[model samples]
Target: MEGIVGYGAYIPRNRIKVEEIAKVWGADAPSYKRGLMLEEKSVPSPDQDTITMSVEAAKNALKRCLINPKDIGAVYIGSESHPYAVKPSGTVLAEALGATPEVHTADFEFACKAGTEGMYVALNLVKTGDIKYGLAVGADTSQGAPGDALEYSAAAGAAAFIFGRENIIANALESYSYMTDTPDFWRREYQYYPQHGGRFTGDPAYFKHVMGAAKGIMDKAGMKPSDFNYVTFHQPNGKFPFRVGKMLGFEKKQIEAGWLVNKLGNTYSGSSPLGLTAILDVSKPGDMILIVSYGSGAGSDAFIFEVTKRIEKVRDLAPKTRDLLDNNRRYLEYGEYAKFRQKIKKAS
Candidate 1:
């Protein structure tokens, strides 16, 4: 069976508090902090972008696995923040891991769900005997328009999953997806920041696709929400996930471990995938995990996994998501954030 053998995530140390952003816009900080349940959001340094972050995350995942880099036959990177508009981040990632010259590589984008899309494909390829192992990554150094609501929540992070048939950690049981021509959020070519449908993004877009996909996967696997030990959904904010979980008959405890949006903001494509990584870090043998990811185009990918005893052997090989979130954080003022994000463009 196809299963996750190794996984890792990278969250940048620099951060911007909601108050710092709200102060610049002359908006109420208490409202955003309480409403979105966000205090501070991660930010990438001037030296870090999607490619560099992806490489770090990939290296961490590789460290947890017992295999040669040359054995990974496929490399897929899913992100909305690729450094180049026309280049493949996958090649750069594969080359960095020394997995090239004999691997299939590609870049993926589906708003926030792109990472799970890559994982879905890699798992299938391994199940089909196409490769010994595959690396799938979801990451973003997201952009938010100045003075817009997104400015408070769009954040930077990455998660990489390595799947193989050997020394399985979490055994994949089933998968499903739901999609439509929803236009709740989008970014046009040459646009620096994305546009959203405001309140329209809630009921009709994010919630619908997420719940639909989650239900579809449970039905396909002949399991109920109560059968899972943990559940995680695409977290646009800290609130959406819990609301969705309750609607789908999952309890607060089921989703709490993976509900990291409050601390990290929405990492776009890395959101739910990173949540799964968090669950894996502490999941016990035989525990079941259900994950559903939503992207803005928009669509959702639902997956069911049952943890294996092998998980205990490697869960500590790399850093846990919580440690990174709690470690040394360099706070940034609005001006410093603008400088780091390149929001203040200098004339050539």
Candidate 2:
């Protein structure tokens, strides 16, 4: 079974508190703080974007594995915020990682679940023996309208996973997906920010698909919530994963290790994968983990993995998700954030 050989995550150092964004919009800070349970989210620098972050994360993933760059047969970059519409982000990432000239590359977009989608393809490719290894990344400089609810949560981050059979770290066990054309969230061509149905994103879209996938995988694997050591869900906000976990019979303590949304905000495609990286960083051999991701176009992907002894040897090879989540953070004021995110209008 081809499984995870190495995994790495990159979270931007800059942060903007929910209060800061709330204040800018003349909304009640306490409301969002209490409701979303989010303190701050990540922000990218002017020079940083999806491609750059993906490259950084790929480098980090490579550091944890023994495979030479040229041996990588595929690289898939999944993001809603790919820098250019026409150019393929995977090619740029492959070139930067020295995996180009002999790689199958594609950029995937399925809202937030795009990363896991890439992971599914990469894993299957390796599973079929067509590729020795594959690099799948979920990275995004997530965006929101100036005063939209998403502004308080959309943030930047990236997670890269190296999939191969050799020296497996977290052995992949089972996978499943649930999807529908719910149209709960979308951004059209030339539209800067996405439009989402407010309460609609919750009950019918995110929750429905997330629950379906979780139950589907557990049933297929003949496992229960208590069967796993840790469970991670797409964290669009700090509260969703916890709420969904409880609803799905997972205890808070069982899910807390991967609950990074409060600290780093929602990394869109990077959200669940980033949380999984954090879990792998601290998990011991034989630990079982269940990860599920939700993308608002209305879908979820679930995977069950068992951590291997190899994790102990390579977990420290690159920066752990916690260290990145906790260290070198610089808070951004509304004005500075406006400039950094290019939200300010320039006088001609």
Clashing pairs in 2: none
Off by over 4 Å in 2: none
Residue lDDT tens for model 2, 8-45: 99999999998889887899999898899999999999
What's model 1's lDDT at 289?
100
Per-prediction TM-score to the true structure, in the order listed = 0.99, 0.99
For candidate 1, lDDT tens digit of each residue in 236-308? Answer: 8888999999999999999998988887999998899889989998899999999999998789999999999
lDDT on C-alpha atoms for all candidate structures: 0.92, 0.93
Q: After superposition, how far is residue 170 of candidate 2 from its true place, in Å?
A: 0.6
How does residue 64 of candidate 2 score in lDDT?
Answer: 95
Worst 10 residues of 2 by lDDT: 16-25
Task: Provide the lDDT at 100 for model 1.
Answer: 81
